[model samples]
Target chain A: MSNNPIGNVWIYIEQDGGAIAPVSLELVCKARELARELKVRTEGVVLGSEIPESLIATLHAYGCDHVFVADDAALKLFSPVPYQKVIVGLAEAHRPNIFLFGATVVGRSLAPRVASRLQAGLTADCTALRIDEFEDKASKRVLKNKLMQIRPAFGGNIIATIVNSWQDPQMVTVREGVMALAEPEEGRKGTVTPVPVALAPEDTAVTIVERFKQPSEVNLKGAQIIVSGGYGVGSKENFRLVYELAETLGAAVGASRAAVDAGWIDHDHQVGQTGVTVRPRCYIACGISGSVQHRAGMSESAKIIAINSDANAPIFSIADYGIVGDLNVVLPKMIRAYRARV
Target chain B: MSLSILVFAKQVPDTANITGQAMKEDGTVNRAALPAIFNPEDLNALELALELRERYGGKVAVCTMGPPAAANILRRALYMGADETILLTDRRFAGADTLATSYALACAARKYGSCDLILCGRQAIDGDTAQVGPQLAEKLDLPQITYVESVEWVRKGRIRAKAQIDGGYEIIEAPTPILLTVLASSNAPRPVGAKRLMQYKKAVTRSELSARHGGRDYEDANLLAAEEEGLRARGLWIYEWGVDDLEADARHFGLAGSPTKVKQIESVVLTGSGTKDVPPTDEGIRDLVHELIEDHILS
Candidate 1:
């Protein structure tokens, strides 16, 4: 262990084009909970090219006790080698009890390298996190302060809770929208520690050739309300009803894997075990039977409403409100009412 | 130059329609009842491997670490056009999490001799951890690109790939001797070719031969040995390697080395305020919409 005592729960602040990603803020919020349970400080580690003070302030607002900044020209773009070098450096110098990363492309690639180099145990794509005590089955020896990493297993058929009791800086990469973001405390104050990042020539072996952001790619994570359809929607052309409901509600359109597999929608719009997990405030399911796989993704929503032809559809079991009817007949009337109200 | 590509695959329990019997009492999946299928994404990885082999002359070898029953996927891989198949099976290799699993795979990869590339699915549907591919790369000390969507080009010992990012896509270039974890949407996997299926349908692993011939001792199974040798000579045999064959440290073989402990597993059921039924009529729809607006469900 380093001479500096380890305690802080660190969040790797992910940013792109100099703007912080929402997932980073969400992780900071999560780290605050872990820190409170462990009685430790919550720190945000930001590595980029001249990160703004406003970004540092945002970290504080989101519950970070301190912000570690390693701003350099070499760190401008997200490269695996250089980012890992700097992160591993920080982890080595000031050992942290827990390191939380948003399971984005950058985090997923970098966490394993850091964990491997450190020989630390990491659980990826966790949906829930908590502090729990672990006991050996045979000897009954107990270990304290274990991070209980809860995630879906066997394609969302079950939830497996994993614990890495041995490794220091217990690492976890959480799904982007699984954790709810904490409200920011504006004017919140925190310390900023500037760290040195020296990049070696060999650290740039893998380079980015080009990056293209397609506006057409669907992102259901940030949607306040989601209007999702399943095979019950009937046909690809009938998918219009789902979209129309979403339009009236000013929400994103999501589809179950069955709809996508049936070629009723693009893969980008899929929400389920093989697709993206979403945690919108309100989710309206139209003609979905709610398979366990589909529920794995959207069960976290604050409220769910199901509309289906069958009253016994599984979606209705989890729904706060159920409408037993053909969505084509019911959605048109709902859309008309919403239009009148607006 | 024929590029040697190694593909890591797994046979997973079909979790599409789960029952109470899907999981056993020990917080482990009950594999006996669940039908095992070639992990869907691994098929995409295999497809990428085959496509690369076709474009730039190379040999593709598919490997999986599972029970003897997993040889089914090896046969499937062969049917799909893999030049070779290796089964890394051993009783001691059971109950491995990502860490130990990757260690055993890395050991087998080293014993397989020189490899220019390694490919795997982004994550197995069963484990859903997505750590093995990257952890395997780290254990092998190779550069890796995960979430790969396309292999653009490979020339002069360097490779370029298009991969999905947070918002869009990124083109990444890395040197050879790298590992890539392909995404599910990367490519449409090809079906089994009739000719390749006929040629590889007789392929069997040594353990399979031992089991079929009703002899635990390898030396006593004379007919099985001869038939295996005949298939081996004809290049229709799947390579079988145990822990001893790979010279893997006993400590790192399976559950002993895994740091993760599954504390509990629960079948999640979402509970809401009991659902209220709304009629199919227009007035019912209108009242429901008004109620939703009043309850702050819809704005």
Candidate 2:
């Protein structure tokens, strides 16, 4: 074995407005898996204004062996320039073989910049990852240590396997809910390595003059129940049925890409490859004929309940429970029944 | 001052609809069976670049990384008013994911040299991996604006663009020599001009000429010289560059240089069953909806 110690796999824990993003935990779980496979430790890199110690302990319970904390007032709000400079600085000092990130809006912006500066290869939106060992026919030797990053390619038609041979730290961004969240281990202990960030006023190229946070109705990713609509809903006005049902169940409203593209719903509610990838416990997909693009995002749901007028719709294939009927007529009566039951 | 803009486009296989022998058993796409067309979003990007060139009295060049046959789109670009076209084709570029692909493109961009702006589609239809533009920007160390819906302002040293986000749009201002990833909603690409189409119809790529030569040479020195002279007269020659031509580091050029690896592929076909076909009557609908609600399929 080489004398150099294998680098730890680090998760860039993302928090906004003093609340941790659900995707951060997802990356922690994924990094734990990679660390176990490679026999390396898992670390969480948290950057914020002043993160609470409780949050740092929570990261430890989530399988992080160490938490690198960089609490700077400049990091209160995400400014790409300062954040990138700090993250790149940390990465340069302590090199990690693999860096796992959540492919959120902020991550999407920062990952590319960091990868470019590090001169490393980054595969975005990876669905799965594993360690592969193989024997080379020509060399007559076994190649035991390799990171295999599997992701949907050609619009999720074929799963392409990408290998970064030249870059030191191979990186990948995972979509939310793609990996199972580890059970928080209470009383777990880990060291907190505090890194100081010297962010100057000149480092900030862009300034956030104003930040408008959309009112929290129901976060689709964190929602236990989701009521979704699709193209079969017909018109934008008819989307009210989906909202009504979701409201009745106290669930979040989701939409297939077709419905979002049709202007029937907002893009944030879109549940597909390009939009938000969701895996709700109980997903009520109304009028959605599950296309590959739609399924690539939500096939991991615990239980799917599909309702469509067409009995042969593909959504039924993945659904644990399915109903064949027009959503317009079925939704109102269903709402009445739910009101009676509750 | 006349500005110069470069638009990067790629001809990817139409993997969206593959069926009935369109894909060989070896998993390679059958190019002949699949229709070759300009990537829809890339065309929108090309249109935005062309509009910029037209509005500012500048030159537009369209560059592509694909096989020799990709010249079809370059010719179309020429007809659309791109002043020049370059094709970066080499066998070594095969099996390139986004990282390798971007490195090759950055090399090509350097070859073009000293452009005021660079434009690319937000993502390719086939890969749908929006990494290339950002990755290219990183490699070139230039300011990048992604998902741009409109070019609000463009002057000599600066450009302000509007990019779409989750709820609203953000206006970003970057200096010139920047990259913009144009969203499909940005603008409708204009149709080819008839006059320009007629003028550049005779355009032929280098691969096409080499194919025409057929390994035979004219016997007389005069005839050989004449053929070379005739080829030059037609403007059919295209500058083809190899890996060495770009002076790219061999360590970071191809599949061997990439770090990510694919382990396995499993085709998942979800299977389940539940059916309810109620009458259009209100009573029947009520009964069906009650069942749906009871099963938690509705609310």
Measured against the true two-chain complex, the DockQ scores of the candidates, in the order shown, are 0.58, 0.28
With candidate 1 superimposed using the best TM-score fit, by how many Å does residue A210's alpha carbon deviate from the native?
1.1
lDDT of 2 by residue, B158-274 (tens): 887777654456677667788888887888888989988887776766556545666354344465457556755755445566677786986666665454445455444445544
Calculate model 2's interface RMSD in Å.
4.5
TM-score of each: 0.91, 0.83
How many collisions between residues are there in candidate 1?
0
Best-performing candidate as measured by lDDT: 1
Kindly list the per-residue Cα lDDT of model 1 for residues A50-155, writing each as its tens digit. Answer: 7988999989999998988999988888877788889988998888989998877788888887887776778887877999888856346787887888877764
Error of 1 at B59 (Å): 0.8
What is the C-alpha lDDT profile of model 1 across B35-81, one tens digit per residue?
Answer: 89999899999999999999889899999999998999999999999
Worst 10 residues of 1 chain A by lDDT: A1-10
